[model samples]
Target: MSFLLTSCSTYPVEVTSADQLAGVWEDFAGRTVEFKGDGTFTATGMDEADVGEECSGVAATQQGALSLSGTYADVTFDGVDCEGMMLAFYGSPSSFVVCFTRDVTAGGCTGELSRKDDVTATGRHE
Candidate 1:
């Protein structure tokens, strides 16, 4: 005789409002994204000398706006800003992520939204 066991984990916390998104998130390249409560955001810690299609870090330095669409938020830059920038939070409010994709139609773009550390927020960093 044998027994079978299974385990499940809670899905990452979905960002629903600007209040939930208001905080600082640092990417793998040491770039930081500061999301403000007033539908405004600022990103820093990127060098203009190194920018390209593959490197989305440049978007971090550009001023952008956020509009929540369901559980995901779309980030559009000003002027000729970064194309296809999206924001999503997982695991917890402390876990922030950003993705660069025009759309995830078909089977969905996997492994794009990476986890980032939440540096600060108004009062929702727990």
Candidate 2:
């Protein structure tokens, strides 16, 4: 008797987008993420080791929207119903330049919009 084994993959294999902002953006730690035209993205191999920080290494599917206005492409993810906004600066020779902002509040887990927010950090595309 003969037996065979196979594996399944959910990652996108062929990603073609005319939009300049569509492509793989690898952060400082090496998480090669791809933002599809359909407003969905998947990033595997994302862990604290790759992030070089304290974080739960759990894979998840996130939906978002991408908007291009003048010189910036505003991308927002709805994993947490407003995780934050990843602002991508256009017209750059570099691979990518993005900054993220989170909705923080004094009352933890209240899910209320805070009056003030801060930029978490900026990352580049790989």
Highest TM-score scorer: 1
> Roughly what TM-score does model 1 have, to 2 decimal places?
0.55
Over 1-126, each residue of candidate 2 has an lDDT whose tens digit, in order, gives 111111111111221232544556544444455656665555544433332222222233334465654333445444433333433332233222332222212111111111111112542112
Models 1 onward score TM values of 0.55, 0.41
lDDT of 2: 0.34
> Per-residue lDDT of 1-126 in model 1, one digit per residue for the tens?
111111111233456778776676554445656778888877675433322364355544467788887545776666545655665433434443444344433212223223244323431222
Candidate 2 collision pairs: none
In every candidate, how many clashes are there?
Answer: 1, 0
Give the alpha-carbon lDDT of every model: 0.49, 0.34
